[model samples]
Target: MAVSGARPRVSWSCDPFASRGRLVHEDDAPPRSAFRRDCDRVIHSTAFRRLRHKTQVFSFNEGDHYRTRLTHTLEVAQVARSIARALGLDEDLAEALALSHDLGHPPFAHSGERALNECMKEQGGFDHNAQSLRVLTRIERRYARFDGLNLSWETLEGIAKHNGPLTDRDGNGVGRYAAGLPHAIQAYNEQQDLELWSHASAEAQVAAIADDIAYDVHDLDDGMRARMFTVDDLADLPLVGNALLEVRTLYPGLDVPRTVGEVLRRVITRFIEDVVTETSRRVAEADVASAQDVRGLGHPLVGFSPEVQKAERAMKDFLFPQMYRHARVERIMEDAQQVVRDLFGHFIAQPGDLPPSWQEGRDALNEERLARRVADYIAGMTDRYALDQHARFFDTTPDLR
Candidate 1:
């Protein structure tokens, strides 16, 4: 029943062997694939571990039960691998991208990123995606032969373009970077072209969507757990509401905790299924032939269906005012941002205050270069470490509660 010369399906997944080699070449260590090595290296990185104390939504002082950056990352990895496996793409590559996605997030998540971006506004701004690339390529020095982990080109490319192309085919900045590219990404692209004009691999796309999924599902869960919202509060919001109705129908008298667990379980599962079905449909529709075909398509092949995307939007619309922008959360985030701002100011005024290692050769740099050096050092701090440093530097620091 099949037409002659027609491909059965679009097979645009990355094959580990076909990867562009690392920035610094090294001999094959064989038993593990390049992507598997990338995952291991990410796990071993100090920046990855620092995520334990970093903010996701709630600060450490707020509550121990809320998700930390590290936990959110693990959830993203799990979702990414599920989506990748379902799509018959490279699961390890997806997982590695998911694990490294947040490595560049400042101590207080988006708030911290905003503060840093403000501090470095003249230095082309601080984009976390760009910082993530820097964390992998420049910071986290554990290699004997190189400054970074020397991950495969595929891994690095995924980290750089997980969200999408940074520029147009002509190398002009696109989207948020319409005026110019971030300094860190631009500097690295000079060393090794991340093909900033094209979409990243299918695996990276998987990681990117997985991040959205994790943020939506988990933030709602955290909101409910914090009592900012209740399970009944989500009883009318499309996908989540449908799940809530199903839970109540199946277990009429279930406790609030049990009902919440069931609803979230269904919500997350539906989101993953929607991704698999929609992405597979797009790939088939596009009739792509190779990984490069996938990348050069100008648009990603990974996402939710229109209906599900609408539902996801509804979820966010609900969360924005009810949870993320809640008075308590705003107050805490404001304090966290001030911590970042204060830390930047303190180090800039007293460059000698920086650790001996960070201060090295900083004397020779011009103003812009010195500011960047200071930014890098502060950007790498864990939330608790940042607070501790703030305490050490000033007479009074914000409570961050």
Candidate 2:
């Protein structure tokens, strides 16, 4: 309800970059601010618009009901907003972070990412989170002078730390960042210091949690609808089956469809409740004249609260065995990787070959720009387009949607 001491200026962990924009929330308004405005900017950005054609699980043509990247992102934003509101968080900040989180994701989820990363490995690895940051900060266009829209620091911090721990250039915490450390943590081992600032905002962590919640449940639903995995099949996997049985015990009359729906709803509600309760307690306890003072807060929403975190962990374990770790998904992933690999090899091997847009460069140095240029070209494609390009260039059979 109220905030504590003067909020420190938000700065990039190592770059000494501070947010330049003003916190523009109206004083009378109970729920909005400049960071919130940043979120709105992301929702309206063109990069955010492309999510509709991106993949969530199945291919574009798999079915109309399947989750597209756009739909998934909307779901993530919705979930994140719910948690933010419950926690008395800056709703706009969470909304903007969730909206822009996936902008850099390639067309085919991790598949397109793998291909792009492999191709650009030498230049800079192509993780979607990094690319999303790149998109918002650089690649996404503007009629204005700069290539990037120059989003607020809050929004960009959310993007960078949405995946894991926020780390400094030397791999230490931002002055006050004290949440869970990133697994396999290392200082920016690379020559380029692209590692996101160590002090990712609490709002960003909330978005990350929202992403996990959205996908973990939806992926199972999608798999079931596609007949890739059945309730019985899922229930048979060791501890997962046991958890499913517990759900059955709780509602004996419920069928698998209803049971799955019930479980998902329960988890969603629990997650939201935990986030709201914890976050509100944090904010209300804070010693606040302004929203700006609340920057760099820790994870307001616990990844797993002591009460439901175990269940959440169990649910994730179940999904891991029953859906994500399933061989069927792996096969699809393999096919996708091959497509990316082949495309990269072909494009790189023939440097003279350029996309129609790149034909104007007339010198040998032009070849040097080819990699970055090709990366730009590939990064902009939707999933369906990426496949088409692969097939067109590789003379492979066209994949049906």
Candidate 3:
């Protein structure tokens, strides 16, 4: 039960024992705090299991060693926990947020998401974040009483606002990324009030930054492994280049894999240290006394410093051209989009094509409702399942491999 090197739990840390309870109340189990229970529930969910076959950057058929959604979630959880532990925040809450962060990602990664979003453009549009909320609050039917997992308010709030507040004080949308809030988030906030105008807990902030760190680091590794780019090619990029330089200086003529591995390990370590140092400085500078104070500070307490942020942006720019927009990736993603579009069109036309569970009561629903239902079913599919369905429905399914 003891965590090694754990700082005394600070006032700004979300106290799991004092957590805001779940929507549909249930008796608490002994020994495990509410946040701990939430972590377990997320790990056990059917959606979590499907992540093994879900794309992170590549299709499931691409290679065995590539990062899937499940692996990415695990990496994010690891980084989040490390940062949370350093900041004396609730590690379980951070881990839970990290694990649940990608639950709404569709079959073919961003391509599938784009296709779904376009398909539902009239029905309030598709957002993976909103879909994630729907998945947690409505989709996963497990409890005898509640439809979703019925996670604690703290967990839900963390999930809702992890990337920062969605609205301003007058309930109008705020932030550079905020337009109108997603329909799922807006609807849920109406019922539960996740304080859309304020920042989430520090643990949630840690998880959000951890997501950025994992994406940057792991995508680089995957990109290298897939031969989309080379380590030598990245030797001029920002943080990555610096890390590679240090690795080369320390161990001259190391093999390519070991050299790349060292660079990645260093990249993760440097980012974690930067976040911990910057967050500690921000917490001290703001004189935050409680979780509420952390939330109301008008800026995130957890983030990279200016230098690191610049470097991170540079790295992303490098990846956008060298990896994300590479001809091979573009070709496969194009096929992936077509597959999602075809599936949506087919299911909307022939409702019976959906499984019995998805088809249930869909006949009674209106066009928008049916479309949303079909979207949900499609969104929940793994890459293999999506491709298989495509193969079944269409005469020629593109070999995404």
Using lDDT as the measure, which candidate wins? 3
For residues 147-255, what per-residue lDDT tens digits would candidate 1 score against the true structure?
9788888899999888899899899999998989998889989999889999999999999999999999999989998999898999889998899998889999999
lDDT, candidate 2, 337-389, per-residue tens: 77767766777676456566554462554543566656656677787777887
Backbone collisions counted per model: 0, 8, 0
User: Which parts of model 2 are misplaced by more than 4 Å?
Assistant: 1-19, 22-37, 164-166, 169-197, 232-259, 280-302, 350-369, 398-401
Report the C-alpha lDDT of model 3 over 1-401, residue by residue, as the tens digit: 22236787889999887877888888988799899999999999999999999999899998999999999999999999988887789999999999999999899999999999999988877889888888999999998998889999999998988988989999998864356887789888887889989999999999999999999999999999999889999888888889999999999999999999999998898899899888888888999999999889898988999999998998899999898999999999999999999999999999998998887777589998899899999999999999899999899799998
Q: Hey, what RMSD does candidate 3 come out at? A: 2.1
Instruction: Tell me each candidate's RMSD, in Å, in order.
Output: 3.6, 7.2, 2.1
**TM-score between model 1 and native:** 0.97
- Give the winner by lDDT: 2 or 3: 3
**Candidate 2 CA-lDDT value:** 0.63
Query: How well does candidate 3 score on lDDT at residue 199?
Result: 94
lDDT of each: 0.89, 0.63, 0.91
